[model samples]
Target: MHVTLIYFTIFFLDFVTHAVKEDSGYWRSKARMEIRRSLSYEWNTNEAKNVIIFVGDGMGPNTITASRIFRSGETSSLAWEDFPHVGLLKTYNTNKQVPDSASTATALFGGIKTNYEVVGVNANVPLRDCEASLNTDNHVESIFSWAQAAGKATGFVTTTRVTHATPAPLYAHSADRKWECESRMPPNATRCKDIARQLIENEPGRNIKVIMGGGRQTLKSNVEATESDPLDAWACSRQDGRDLVDTWKRDKSARKVKFAVAENNEQLRKVDTDQAEYLLGIFANSHISMDWKRDQGPKGQPSLEDMTVKALKILEKSANGYLLVVEGGLIDFAHHRGQAAQALRETVRLSDAVNATLQIIRTEDTLLIVTSDHSHSLAFNGYSDRGTSILGIAQRSKHDNTAYTTLSYSTGGPNNYAYEITNNKAVRVDPSRFDTNEFTYSQQAAIITDEAYHGGCDVAIFAIGPYAHLFHSVHEQNYVAEVVAFASSIGEYGNKENSASIFAVDCILSFGLFLTMLM
Candidate 1:
């Protein structure tokens, strides 16, 4: 009986030990997964004292690469490449594969995916529907509005007119993004409403702190008699009838809107920052000219970097930090014109702007985001070495040491010209119907490339500072709003950090996959 009892006791002990081992393994696995989720969730929830979103309108991966080559020469990386974090972002709209600037900018500002050509409204509505009347009228709010509500200073700065689509998303809520300036019949006052007016009237007493860039004429209807509307003839004007400049002399709140209206660099430099909390600076009636065309000293247009730096200086003064939006708005214009040289130069200007902002940002406390709304159908083809001239197109044999003229117009036009169509071989030519005058005047023959004639391609996205890692993986255009909201430490996740380099790993994997395919 004693022997039987001992064997039974030993068997029971063994059973207990085995069960414990199995349970421990299962718990460990569960714990590991929980930790990963926690980290990722936190990675999406970091905060910053200031948020700076730098937009390179119409920029793409190739555009960034070419800009890097242009700025640092063939071998150097872009200034922003040194940012400690990086991530990819998608630029698609809900209804269209190819998105317009209006809807894309709306995604960034409103955190909602919208359809093409629509602005500040959700995607479900009909194209002809007005955004102001949509049921979502109050449900969808812009980042600027959120920042304002949070008591943080907010500003919008760009090379485009203040009323343009890229900047409109921040302050204006409208169905039609093209509502630039309203007009009426010859006898009547311009009765139509525009986005610019909506922004100015949105909040009567709240001060936005800093409003800069071109668009003087859009704001004023009344002016002293002059060649142009005397009121708006200045680079900047306070059309609200408050005479913010005079108020700056007396009233405290009016003084807060003290502004500088400069049409050139000279006027920009003379503004007194010591006296004003809110500023309005316009350098031109429309978008500023290209950097190459701009003059230096008092006459030249300000570089994107100059505008960015100035904007930060004003925004950082807020005790509660600030949200600032800066745009290199002309890169899109260059792409629309199919001028590669102009587009590349504008991209370099954007890189310079990013570099300037990063220099001022010390704490991983500030979140800096750089991206484009969508990509243009642009590409660089042909096999070339590192130092090969990007300006010229030459084709070299993939495996052998032979070279041929790789860049020429399939339409039998000059290489310098841009045509609308491309042949079966991926060569470009102008569509027969388009007037020659419509294309920019070029002395050289036009080359037609298949890629140039089409649309719908992935754009570029890059970010740094807290929670920026959340931008990784395939995501929607609204993901940008999520990332910004997360990084601001505003919604869902808050005060979390991502030190795991998961995003970095993903980037590496993507690069390797691309190289593997090439091999």
Candidate 2:
């Protein structure tokens, strides 16, 4: 609703042209559809029963725009773009201009910005020095903890390992994000705990109703891996000789807690929500496969949409409602590899997960937020035709008679960095050597580096439901957690008028969106 119309003029003209050619009644039909939206746009002032946050890692404005273009050529929007409230925020960390996931995710979930590589701890804690963080006094609790204390079921789902930086802050507290398992701890940091141990043994962690994702090796030994022995050829393996997965199951059995564990998509689908009190699903020994590599057979993990649907079913069992975080994390990794085709496909898969979540819950009482932790340096260039293939070469660079695609990154990957540095992209490359449209092909980059870098730019936050209007202005990244806590009537900002304020903002934002769409 708060989006700019100028940026969408191209899309608007395309629709109008089609309508005029199809039938004279098409315009009238479109007007009635807008009226229906106006009716469905009412704001509910009552306390929200649920809050879901959908995060797209490394999704920036450039990333979104390029993805929109590549998805179907002329389309200019995704599912979240239709939301009633949208705004941009600065993503800088307290100590660095371009923040990493540890600090940025901590700010979003803990409501306090800290130094780089610091997760679920305050700014007073130094990065990677666990000796200085041996005590519990330095731990910073995230919003998930607040939800648990309030008697609400809390959970998180991501394509990355549940012990990864983003999800770790939701439940685990450590001096460093890299301390994923007991064996990974530094020599002098044995006094402290690893993130995986904390997740299965600590407060909010043990109490969580659902924990799903990859990281089997972080808990089970590499020898026990089901899909592949020693699992992904690219992932780290556990070497501590302890089977924490079995230990976790033993603890649950001794406590008489009813639980279900699934290793593949088929097993997860058979879980009966009515009978199971807890669910644990780990699909890979490391991070789950990317969208291109996803196979839903007996040996494969569930897709992002599959995971969201299952998580929602488990969480909705609570009468008090729930708070769940679903993250599409591999967009960052694909970008790191300079694979635009792969990265854009991941974003589309993320959008599919968001749409699936919407089908299970009504928007009137639920607060849904879709955003990114940070951005990559990927961008689109050249003024080609509106409906031209987004992945097709738009022009032959004057710098060298070599052709270039609309999408390219600042730096990263072998074909991009090494090929460019060695020949300066001036080797009169054969167009047939690589197919930009192929799902596995790597995209192009400008400079040379082993991995792409995060960008120092503002990222957009799209929202719908109560109190979303409070996010209209440009603000610090930490302010997002404050707005979420206020809307849900939790934490320090919980008060008598919280619901009233939320209702008021809903009406205002809906009206603003209506006017913008009319223009």
Candidate 3:
């Protein structure tokens, strides 16, 4: 009986080894298929009639990899990963190595590297310098302005407040990104306008065909809380007593243009794209709930995917084409709170939005770019097995003999050092005792501080459609705006004179290369 059992054990081990080895052929075949696809790939050089940019805030390399593993197994890829052109962007601001959303947004949209915490203005204007920001020489126009000048419909969508830093650069020129409303502005700064006020009163902002996101509190006047006014319960209304929402509606009405204001998911869905010349959606008083916590409250807010699809419907009505900016802004918020689960889920939500856009728009005439403003300090550590859960503990620390999560921040989190005094000495707490995969679980961090810091590492840029090949190498973050301008024949590259100059330069370079070959 003992001999028979030993032979059976040996047979089972052999079967398991052979089963695992069988996957090698599958991997080799998949690699060969990818090579063939690359060889047959063709560039789309058509003039980009429509431009859509997706910004995944704080989505670093570590975040992408972990999210990929979490959503699918180790070998799978996100929707944007299949983009033909991939590049790395230097995300440093003019004044800071590790950048903030405002400066990075300025670089990405305004095509200039500006001072940290400043948006839609040049580096000459320091942070919170209202006087300098008011100078016309210091003002920088973004791609939205260019698109508007070219007669293209312009719009933006985000999971954060519409006046948030990532979306602010599109229209609002602010010395301080924190000035979301008059309430947040300094008392002495009478000349400078708040970001929310700029959205309703300024040029490009007033002209935007679609404005969808949160910040009802910033736009509405302060009112007494009542059961009938559920939205005002969480509201910190503007101190100016001016309801920008009402102002926006009145402005649109005065222009004699048909417009719609949607306050919830149902209202947004009911908007008539064919008739409404403008659409403004404010679903939350603050930043929209994270993907994990979305739709769990009394009011229903649209998902990122939901907002993207609806925005595309309205923008597609323009004859001269359109420019749409969509931001997965909550990924950064989740990372700031050290919630890796929420961050990864937010990334997946972004992926879903991208996929939804793909289904609605054709790549032939549209330029779609996906990138991040900055990255977080989220670190993916350990050598776990292939099938191990991304949120699960990878291994026990050799030093303390305590288990650690695979996903952890490099520094700054509330639950950084979970420990107990056992022999009058602190020891690392084992995370395996509780459900680390829980959406609320705070990932372990190296040090506890106010929040996790933004990483200085270069972020990834993925592009598809017209002139997407422009992003085939490393570049400064500002290069993105230049490529969009060139592809769409807008901004500095819009005129025939500039196109002629570029053609002349190309011809000269070709002639030089021909002479060198003869030599």
Instruction: Using lDDT, give the best candidate's number.
Output: 3
Alpha-carbon TM-score of each model against the true structure: 0.70, 0.86, 0.90
> How would you encode candidate 2's per-residue C-alpha lDDT over 1-519 as one tens digit per residue?
212342254357445764475466766765675566546554546667788999898888888887777676543467687777789878998889999888889888988888898778888889887866665677777888888877788888989888888888898777888888866677988788888888888888888888898888787665465544236444445677777677768778898978888889889999887877788888877888888877768767899889889989989988887899988898887888878877888898888888788778877778889999998888788956677777767777788667777777888767664242444544544343578777666666667677788888999998877777777878898888877777787766456576677668889999999999999
> Residue 406 in candidate 3 has what lDDT?
89
| Candidate 2 collision pairs | none
Please provide, for model 3 over 327-377, each residue's C-alpha lDDT reduced to its tens digit, 9 standing for 90 to 100.
999999889989899999999999999988987998889999999999999
Candidate 1 vs candidate 2: the TM-score winner is: 2
**Candidate closer to the true structure by lDDT (higher is better), 2 or 3:** 3
Model 1 C-alpha lDDT per residue in residues 255-283, reported as the tens digit of each score:
45555555567776766666557666766
Residue 516 displacement in candidate 2 (angstroms): 42
lDDT of each: 0.62, 0.79, 0.87
Q: How does model 1 score by TM-score?
A: 0.70
Cα-lDDT of candidate 2: 0.79
Query: Candidate 2 versus the native: TM-score?
Result: 0.86
